[model samples]
Target: MMYKADHKDSFPEKPGLAGLKVLADQNYLSDPAVFRNPADAKTTLAGELKALAPNNVSYVYFGALPDVPVAPAKMPLAFERPDLRLNGNLCVLFGDGHVESLTVPVEVDDCEELVSYLHTQKKYSEKELKALSERAHLLDGELGL
Candidate 1:
């Protein structure tokens, strides 16, 4: 939030999760350990504290976040990458600054889960919805759903 406050409510825009470097580069966060999940042993602590590599990071930064969204609580910011998720659940960081564990469900779930939940439950504007879907597709592919 501090970074957003300073940077006109925009996040570090980069491909996939690499944008997280903005946090360290901009000094919002200095430690790479902060990005890792303690439960994930596969991901090692970065030697140089950079999110540039997927193996060293635990989460995927969804790129479709709006500036000062009206329903921040309903938006998905970032989530634990599929391999990092335990027991078929991923921890999601919402726009409201809350974290939740989401059950893994493929489109076969009828609801198609994940992105479907965002579209139906959140009701973001057309532009925001398009952005969210684009980013969510990348994440869904990683999750294999």
Candidate 2:
């Protein structure tokens, strides 16, 4: 969904996806349909959290449900329907105990890309590299990426 600032007065708290096993219990993990859309695609919040167990990584998600379908092809022909509503946040816990919130959609992609790129970073910590690989595997499981 397109990002919009609803409560501009408060800086949204950044939380990491790591260590958030509760998501599996939230309707998100149980509802098979949630991940069916391409635009709805994402690495399981649990998986991302698990991968960051050894590093300083955090994430948060906030907003209404994304209006974009997982795949554009799945969008309806009707062009004037009201958008769906989705609201939530994700938090990540890094090895350093630092937490951050992922407030934007593209931020998620950038985070994943950073994790993937970590594999090639010179002198990157072995712990961080392993976490990134694990996170990549988790994404593959959830998004088939």
Give per-model TM-scores. Answer: 0.73, 0.26
User: What is candidate 1's lDDT per residue for 9-30, written digit by digit as tens?
Assistant: 7666553555677677788878
**lDDT scores of the candidates, listed in order:** 0.65, 0.29
Error of 1 at 123 (Å): 4.8
TM-score result, candidate 1 = 0.73
User: Best-fitting candidate, measured by TM-score?
Assistant: 1
Error of 1 at 68 (Å): 11
What candidate 2 gets wrong by more than 4 Å, as runs, is 1-92, 101-112, 117-123, 126-128
| Total backbone collisions for each predicted model | 1, 29
